[model samples]
Target chain A: MARKIDPDQREQHKAAIAEAVWRLVARSGLEAVSLREVAGEAGVSVGRVQHYFGTKDALLLYGLRLAQQRMEGRIRRRIAGLVAPGAEDVLRATLAELLGDDPDTRQAVRVWTAFLGRALDDRAIAEALFADDVELRAFTTEVVGSPLDAHGLWALANGLAAEVACGQTTAADARAVVDHHLDRLLGSPDR
Target chain B: MARKIDPDQREQHKAAIAEAVWRLVARSGLEAVSLREVAGEAGVSVGRVQHYFGTKDALLLYGLRLAQQRMEGRIRRRIAGLVAPGAEDVLRATLAELLGDDPDTRQAVRVWTAFLGRALDDRAIAEALFADDVELRAFTTEVVGSPLDAHGLWALANGLAAEVACGQTTAADARAVVDHHLDRLLGSPDR
Candidate 1:
């Protein structure tokens, strides 16, 4: 009898492949990623991994997209738990989530920085990355009431993420800086 | 007859090798940098390149230090050209030079980000890079009047540099954002 092909299992296998890619990227930089290596890391056949993602580029893109989705989902869930959350609260929560030094944020930063390097040479990735920036800026502008300050805030958050990821600044220090900046921008009452 | 090696010529050759490493990094990411590849790019013998820098780590450190010195020198020259330059002027010029979208800054960003990745796993490089940040924060504090705000400003500038290098924002736009933040922080008269 032919083996059954479960769609849910297929999705889980793809997720496993993406997680393996992230692990490889975090441990050895993006240059270490290869289909054969990923298969080895994922504990799957190369042909099975290939069945989901055709090329290394496709695999990378898929991983990046998956990471972003996971990040957004976490932010959404956090915000959803707030009672009548103000824009400032939402903004602070989102930026805090992005700049958090948790394992997820750490992995995302590694993958994101690796992608930033590749985006320099790939037009499609460049466009996708820039589009995300535009969306982020728009959301920030809604909270800050000034487009310029919103840009500054975005840059500041990203800078903090890099600093935190690199251990130049602790996560708590990063959180304090983000809160201070938010207070300055929003004039919110001191916590 | 022994071929004489002039000190100045030797310095020039080392500088050329560093430049080749930067070029390779900017073109193909940090993974592309190898002694043999650098020698090929610099049009020199591998032994000659290896003689100056004993390992890849040493070579990368040398390149980063050279780039930082060059950047500081450029900032000093720019600030010196200003008439009655205040701390704000000095700060602005230094940051403008750092965040400039010129080829030098572009290459520096590529090399810097590449080094950032390695610094995650290399303790010596992390220490070196963190030391640079601490020095920058002290200098910025002198200009910004607050150590915390100075750190924030430093993070903002670094983030803007990354964005500009990655094509998410234009150099001019980044300059404008920097100026606005400086004005907010320094209360400098509009230029």
Candidate 2:
């Protein structure tokens, strides 16, 4: 009888391979990411990568999904530690997470930017990337308790973060911009 | 003695080569942009492309510059045709221009996005892309009559446009988001 694969170990293997994909993408670009190179980057055999991800396109999409999941995890962790975080605080934490202040997230953003470049022409890629962004917008809408305001707020906050990620703006400047918009949107502090 | 160069023809040649760079980049990704490939795409000789751009790095950067210049020219033409355009009207036009409503712009954004991905890790590319964005912010500031608000406005508007370009948001949703933010922003209409 064939040995059963451990579900936990399978996830670990997939995430590890996805991490390699992100690394290669951040280093060069999406077009540079090949299964062979990704396998080498991850110190695994090409067969192992193919075993988990099946095809290059599937691997690329999975890498992006993993990136989104990781970002969401970061947001959740940051908010989890707050003693009494309000909606504004939660939103701030979320935006801050998106700023990609740390190395891992910054790398992820680089990977994302490259994929986003190709996504415009590739409908499947576009839909996958759009789904990730929609999740963010959905969370923002839930937090704001108003769909009308959330769209703009999500765009502004993530836009600012993206500027930071791409080095178009400083973290400080993005924070200031975020605060300026939030101040106008939220008005006086609730508590 | 070399043949005399016509300044107009020189610009046309450079723009044509750069346009080829954009098409290749938009079709594939920046990594796909090789000097020889760009020449092939432009139906020019490798020597001609090298003569104009010197190196692949210079060619890529020049392509981005040409793209930005074309966008500016478009924006100027749009605004110039407007009879007695107001600050709000001018801002709206600028924002709309950024929406990448046409195939050309949508393709350009794909190129920019790829560059932006690499820009995160490459200082030169980041600075070049940042400079383009800064010019847009400066223009927005000039229109807003307030530097304080321009950063937020520029980010929001372009952020919305980028979302549309990436297929992350519908043109309708982005426009509604822009109008919502602008309504809160501009207050009562001024004829």
Top TM-score: which candidate number? 1
lDDT of 2 by residue, A89-131 (tens): 8887877766646778677666667776677667787776667
The DockQ values of the predictions, listed in order, are 0.51, 0.50
C-alpha TM-score for every candidate? 0.91, 0.86
Q: In model 2, where do residues sit more than 4 Å from their true spots?
A: A84-89, A100-102, A142-148, B31-37, B45-47, B86-88, B100-103, B142-148
For residue B179, give model 1's deviation from the true position in Å.
Answer: 0.8
Pairs of residues at least 3 apart in sequence or in different chains that clash in candidate 2: none
- Give the C-alpha miss distance for residue B31 in model 1, angstroms: 3.2
CAPRI quality of model 2: medium
